[model samples]
Every structure is written in structure tokens, then in C-alpha cells.
Target chain A: MFTGLCAFPLTPFKDEQFDPVAFARIINNLTDAKVDAICAMGSTGLYPYLNNDERRTVAENAVALADGIPVMAGIGALRTRDVLHNADIVQRAGVNAVLLAPMSYHHLHDEEVYALYEKVTANLSVPLCVYENPNATNFTFSDELYQAISRLPNVAAVKIPGMPFGDKVQGEQRLARLRELVPDSLSIGVSADKFGVAGMRAGCDAWHSVLAGLFPKTVQCLIQAVRDGQGESAAMASDRLSPIWQLFVQSKGGLRVMATAADILGVCEGNCLPHPLKPLTGPARQELEAQLTSLQLD
Target chain B: MFTGLCAFPLTPFKDEQFDPVAFARIINNLTDAKVDAICAMGSTGLYPYLNNDERRTVAENAVALADGIPVMAGIGALRTRDVLHNADIVQRAGVNAVLLAPMSYHHLHDEEVYALYEKVTANLSVPLCVYENPNATNFTFSDELYQAISRLPNVAAVKIPGMPFGDKVQGEQRLARLRELVPDSLSIGVSADKFGVAGMRAGCDAWHSVLAGLFPKTVQCLIQAVRDGQGESAAMASDRLSPIWQLFVQSKGGLRVMATAADILGVCEGNCLPHPLKPLTGPARQELEAQLTSLQLD
Candidate 1:
């Protein structure tokens, strides 16, 4: 089962090309920070925007740069065939596990969605995680779907969106409810910056994080605090990073805010292509800088 | 404004490779049958299942073999950037126009959906058709969405699923409503095998078809009858093809039953990957063959 903090790094581009060197630097830092697993080509990484070759470059480079850290590559596409093909490429690239999102161009029914995972895993011999990001996929997995998917081969974990933004009861209670539904062998991870500590407290095996990619110190501290059941330090870390989490919520993690944060902390260059959200600039940059200084990112 | 019988062609495969020769044969036959515009890489072509290179091959081969006929290539993906990239490739491949389905992996709001078209068209110099396959996208185009999208540059047409399977009143009233809302320049089409004559009778500007991909003679005849308001002949054509249409309805166009019809009619080998629906096997093929013989596909 996949566990601990999984860092999802941004795919930084340079000179209108996928800069493998720039991406490598970010992977090295995440590894240096002792992140358990590095997740590449996630929603945060803007997987859909990158071309096929760029995606391959990002995955291969991430694996090579990571110093023994298991790399979990996002391998979701509109078709099951493409996802399967992506899994094969990433596996060949030496990723430890693939985070598979059941992405679709159509409103897929439960059976069709389940069959997608089945067909994909039929070709997959490596470890896989079911990426249940409802915000991205528009379809939430029922406990039944989760149970069926868990029975699929090599399903090491299931990463659900942390807190399911805007739901009234938006904390550990939701994660706890999820834990009760899945099998004991199937690991669960949460995918929101705000809910990292709360997620660990709620029995999540890992924190599949976007913010942790940039500011690993706080995330690692938060993960430790929750593991020790020290609510105060967990609260402290969450409070310290509240501003960035707010930015993520507001911007939908599209802009290169996380990349900018990494750049500010001397991790990697903060550049992205096909900018889906407003990049941190002017006032936003100043605010992020002030927050980073206060936190002392190193 | 692409009008009349727009024959969408099947992407045939041989030795698990996209058979350009087989695909070209189907395209030639459609042109011979006098289809106005031959739309390649349509849903009938089993598009999403194909890889990036495979998709490129299908579009390019369709254009090269179309014999001077206007080709409308389907260009839809999980991201706006990818769509723009695909539009460039298909345009470079020499397609006249692109049929774009605003396919999303996420639940996109109206503004986000509108912005997708804006961003895509900003990169495109070619004509674009909005393929609002609600069943596929999960988001229906409201009159507000339609008006906003219509104002975007180069949006020439909109294709909505006709009969909206299982809606109590499965008729042309919705098409009339769509027509009343859209601008005069924006052509409206329906995507249902059963709705062709009725859609034309109900004043659909075009027929975005699946059956036309194979049996062009019947489709062209249906189109002409509808144009001349020959409801009786239209009914006869619809009646003649009802068994096949029934199968399409049952399968939701996943089985490539149309491709099977192409095979039955000796157009091209009817084979598809990642079959979304049940294939024409056992009793289904026998039933289809009897129906095809009655229509006399020669």
C-alpha cells in the first residue's frame, strides 16, 4: 500500500520546450525534502495540456531524477486505451505506481467506469492507484465502485479529493466515512493541501499533495504531527500554510502558483504553458513571498 | 455552413494498425455516393480509443483520400490546449472544417466552457462546429451557453443529440426550441439515426450522422426527401433502417454497428477497438444482415 506524503510537482517549461533540466531540479528537491513519493502529470501538473512526448519526457525525467523515491505518475486520459498506453510508457520510464483517474469524454455509468479500470489493469502489471478526483472527473465513486475497483489487480491505493470542497461537513468526518467503506488492505490518500494533517488523523495512508510539492517542510511536519496525534502542531502547520491553501481553492490549482512558490524557495523555475489559471504575479506574488518569508521555507 | 448529407466514415484497422487503405476505401465510396462533406475521426470512427499518432493518421488519411470533398475532422480532447493542438494537426492534414465536441474531464461551468471555445478558436483560423453531445460532456448547452458560444468567431454549427434517449417526449420540439434561440448564421444539427427525417422535418439545419458513414445512398435519399418535404419517403427510409437504428439505440453507438454495416455492405472491414457497446455478434449480425439485404446495399 502507498503511504506518506506524495509530492505532485509542476511541469516547468523553458524556451517553449519541456525543460527536463528544470523539471529534474524540482524532483531532486522533493526527494531531498524526503517526500515519500513524487507524483508527476497530476491535475496540478496540467497533464492534459502537455503533448504525448512532453508527458513521456516529464515522467521519464521525474523517475531518473528522484533519488530512490517511488514516483507515482498520473496516467488518466479520455479513453481507456490511451490510459493503458500511458501506463505502459510510464512503467517503462520506471515509475513505481500509476495514479489512474477514470477520465471520460462521456457521462460514463458505474459499470462502464468499472470496466474501464478493469480493461486498463488487464494490461497493467505494475502497482496502480485509483485517482478519485470528482472535481476533475465529474463522477464520484460510490462505495460499490470503490469496492469493485479495489478487487482489480495492483490497486495499492485510492486517492480521493481532500474534504470535497464546499461540502458542509468538510473535514475528518468525510475521510472517516470513506475509510469505513473501503477494504482494510486498500490504502487511502487525501488530495488537498488544507486537509493534509486532518486527512492523516482521519486514517488516510498518504497525503497526495500539490502544495507539499513546493513547501515540503511544513507538509512533512504536518504529517509527523498528525502521526504522533499532536493536534496543536498540525493545526499550527495548517494555519501557517492557510494563505497558500486559500490561493489553491480560489485558483483551482491551474496557475503555476505552486511552481512560483518552488522558484521563490530556489527549487525550480516557475514557468508553465497553456496557463489555465492566473499565475502568481504583482500583488499575488508579493503576498506569496511574504507568506514564504514568514514560514522560512528552508 | 456545412449542409446536406455529411457522411462520417469509420476508421478501419488491420493487424491492429489503423488501415489507411481500408479507411480510404470507405471515404471513396462515400464520395461516390455523393455525400456533401465527409466528416472523419467522428465518434463513429471510435476516436477516443485511438492514440495521438493513430488519431493523426486517421485525419490525414481521410483528407488525402477524400477526392476534393470537404472534410470535417472531429477534434475534441480533455483540454482546450489539446483541442487547439489537434485543430492545427487536422488543419495541416487538409480538413475543410472541424467538428469539435467540448468534451471535459471536469464539470465545467458556463464561463469556463465558453472560455474553452474562446481559447481554442483564438488559435484556429478554420471553421468550427460545436458538438454539444450532452450524454458525453454531461453539461447541456443552455440557450445562454449557445448564444455566448455562437458569438465566438468561426463557430459555424451546433450538433445536439436528437431524441435524448428516454426523455418522455422524444421528438423534434427540442430542436425547434434550439432553432428559435440560436442566430441565423449558426446551423443546428441533430445526432440520432432515428431523428434524420424527423429532424429535417422539425427544421434541423443539418444531419450530423452515423448511418451516413456507411450507407450513404439511403442517407442521401433521406436528406433529399426531407429537403423536398417528402415525409412519406422519409418515413419509408426511416422504417427501412429502423432495425439498425434500434441496434444503435441499444448499443449507444459503442459497438461500431455502423462499421459492421460497412463490412456487411463490403465498404471496409468493420473492426473497432475499445468497443464501448456490444459488437454485432451471434444473432445480432444475422438480424442486421437480413435488414441490410432488404435495403439492398449495392
Candidate 2:
């Protein structure tokens, strides 16, 4: 049940406060779309920007509004004490799982990163996903580190960055190599929304997606096509959004682009991002609106 | 008065709490050495790992215990609102100056970074130091960004990463170029302790140091020799500590090694670092002790 499209939603804010009504609207939209799981507080959810109390409030709202679908929350923080503190909070708030990125200010050693996971996983009452996001966290997990972490108890999945595999042969070989390292019980999920179709066709068990948070049916169909072995359909689906993917690349990462898309779709009211992160502005905003109109993405 | 060796002291902790007594010992050591300034809550101080209230207490103690040494506190956070909030706290706690690093989870655009400094500086009653520790913050500041930020109100200094200038000629030229870009009012400070001697000899106005936190007199002599234009003596002083400098290179930016040295020196009780960060272990610890003894560093 945990191994499918896990949509990461933006924790919308209004007047620098968590906008519960706006948040509920987005949650209800994802529920209606029946995404495999709702991951609140992912990077796209601005987990690091929010305090623990705000995160707990967001987690509770996610669980309460998600209908029967499972909910996961990001528990990453700069300190181990805070991560563990967050692990307890989200679990008590009734999340089915927690995603932990080894968030750092000081670059962490491999031993320290492993120790962080070991300490957190030991305290989890629910399944944990080892989030390996080098772009945001600046800590890359080696293949050996991955195998070691996957051996820890209650580790249900490993969310990996998208691979730039040129073809199915490379994609399959890469996934096959990773598969050999971890237990069969561990689901392999791919993020970097642009590469989800390629990853799904590469035989990844799940797509941890930012796009799916705002446009679930769009990504759901792409995943469903891959599952049904319709390679042409999945490829076409991904190809259709090349401009948006280009925008993701040019914007540095998906967080800003996804937030803009959410606001454009009216899923989040405009100007939803927290401070130090504004929505797409000027040409970028105009380009996004033009693309949405041409793509008929409503 | 703002320029010279600004010693960065560890905010020592005992049992997951700020150990003010131990913290006072480190501050007193820097004060006794007559360092030009004491910068509390730097990366060496584990600022990002500390919460705002904890940071407030650390700043208050630093100002109270510094004995009029011109205390500067780090006020960087992931959000602009929080940075402003911390600015208010640290300033109210009576810091003479505040350091802003533009700490990030998502990599920030240059425009966003400029806007961050703009927002924080607009509300500050005290002068600000632009902390450019890319290794820790993961956001590199361009020279143009430095130029822009240096022009902002309250920006008295720009702390740059220590450049690997091979000789005094290169250092002079590089510093001269940077000098042209910023106003004459801005003091240029260099960090990365291994390169501080070269930077100081090359005419950087200040050395923002980690080693100075634990062994203030040791670093003080090096900076002092340069100030007195004792070229041969300064070179010799730096050359004598080649092995310690090599340790900083191996130990990943001096935070861990400083923590270990602090414990060994009894400046901090053992296990002084916050969780997810540990002091040097195994052979690294043994090697640090051997070097300390050989160098007669107190």
C-alpha cells in the first residue's frame, strides 16, 4: 500500500501562518485523486522552514483530511534531538510513516549520517523512508551506505534521486544494481518529478512526486501507463510536459516551480510560499501561466 | 576595533543543555587572550543546531561574560522571518554586532539571498557581518553579491572563505580586486583557519578563527607577528603548526576537532557537541592530543 505515487503537497501559508482552509482544499483534492500516499512536510512542503509545532499541525491536518489514504510526514531537522523529537510528534499525530533526510549545516561524515539513521530508526513506531536528497541536504548516501541503512529495522523504502538514464538498458541495469543491494521488502522510490516516468519504466516501485501533489491525475496516469507496460503512452505523457520540466531545471529545483503550479491551479492561493522563498516572478511566472494554458493542465 | 582575530567559541553543552559554566570558561579564555572580538554562535558554536531561545540565552551569556570584548552573535536561520526574529533577540540580548550566513535548505537564488540580507539588515540596530562559509551554509556568495550586500545598511564587514593564495603577491592582487568591488568602509575578514596566516599576511583586516576558540594565545601570536610586520617570525609561527593545520584539513572544517580539543583542554566537558555532531574519535582523538602536547599549546 505504501509503494506507489506518494504526492508531496505544499503546506500553504497565509499571513505567515499555516492556512488550514487552503491546506484542507489541497488535501481534499489529493484525496479525490486517490494518490497512493500523502507526504506532508517534504522539501516541497517547506518542512525545514516550519517549526515542530507547525509541522505537527500540518501532519494532523493531513491525516484528518486524507480520508483512508496513508499519510507520511518529513521529520528531518538540523539536530538529531530535533529529528527524534519530530519522529515522536508525527507518530503521535498518526502518520503511517516518516521520511528523514539527514539535514545538515555542518557537512556530516558517513559514520555520523549512519548513526543519525540508526538512532532515529530505533525509535520509530511506524515505517521509515531513508530520504537521500543531496541537493537539499548536501549529504549523499553511498551505495554501501544505502545497503547498510536498508538493513535497519522498520525501513520500508529508500527514496532516491532520479537517474539520468539514457535508455531502458541503462535504467534497468542501474535499478538492478540497486536491487541487489537491499532486501526485497524495501520499496525503491524515485523523486525529481521529471524523471518519474523513466524511473517507473525502469521498474522503480514508487514515484515520490511534487507534481502529483497539485496534478495527481496527470502523474497517476503516467504511472498507471508504465504499470500496464504501455511504454509509448508513458513516454508520450512525460514528453508532453517538456517545457515544464525545462522550467524545473532553469528554476534550480522543483520546490519553487511546484509552488507556482499550485498557486496557478488555485490549489494554493497566490503568494503561498514562506519567507526567503517567493513564488516564480516576472518572466518565470508569465511563462508558467502560458505553459499551463497551452498544456490545458487544469 | 572590529578588525583583528575574532575568536569563535564553542557554545559548550552539558546533558543536552547549554553549559553556561563551560561556555563561560571558553569566553574567558578568549577574553584573557585579549582577542579583538568574541563571535558566539558561529558554525563552531553550532548556531544552526540551536533553537532561537537557546541562541538568545547563549547571546545573553556571551554579552554578559565577554567583559566588554565587543560580542558578536550569529543570527542566521532558514527563514527570513526567523532571521529577523533572531536579529531582534540577539540585539536585545546586547550583541555589539550580528553575523548573517543566509542559511538554506533549498539552495537560494542570488536575488533571494540579496533580498534576505536586505530584509534582515533593514531591521537591525547593530552592524552586520556577511558570513560566507560555503562549506557549512552550502551557498556560495559571488563577488557581485558581496558588493551588493556590502552596500546595505549596517553591513560593516564581509567574511569570506579563505582563498588558497599561493603567495603574498597573489593574495594582495586578489584582495585588491575584492577591495575595488566593495566600499572602503567594509572590513574584509577571512576564515578557514589553515589559510588565516596567509590571508593575514596578505592584508585581510581580520581572521575569523575556530582554533582561536580553544587555543587563543597560539593563534594570537601568529596574528600578532603579522601585525608587527615580523614576516619571518609569522611564517615560522605558522610553519611550526603544519601538523595541526593538516589536521584541520583532514577533520572537515575544524568544528569536530575544536570540540575534541575543547574537551581535552577542559574548556568543555566531554561530549559537548549537540547530537548528530560528535567530537573526533579513535585515532583522530589520539593524534590531536599528541600534536597538542608536542606543540605545548595551552
Q: Pick the candidate with the highest TM-score.
A: 2
Task: For candidate 2, write residues A69-129 as lDDT tens digits.
Answer: 9999999998889999999999999999999999988888888888899999999999999
Per-residue lDDT of candidate 1, residues A111-224 (tens digit): 767877888888887888998876666668987888888888887788887765324256556766766776787788888778777767766788888877766666888888
- Residues B84-154, model 1: lDDT tens digits: 77888888888888887766543445666787788887777788888877666666777888878887888
Distance (Å) between predicted and true CA of A265, model 1? 7.5
For candidate 2, the TM-score is 0.96
> Model 2: how large is the Cα RMSD against the reference?
1.7
**Given candidate 2, what's the lDDT at residue A186?**
92
Docking quality tier of model 1: incorrect
lDDT value, candidate 1, whole model: 0.73
Local accuracy by lDDT, each model: 0.73, 0.88
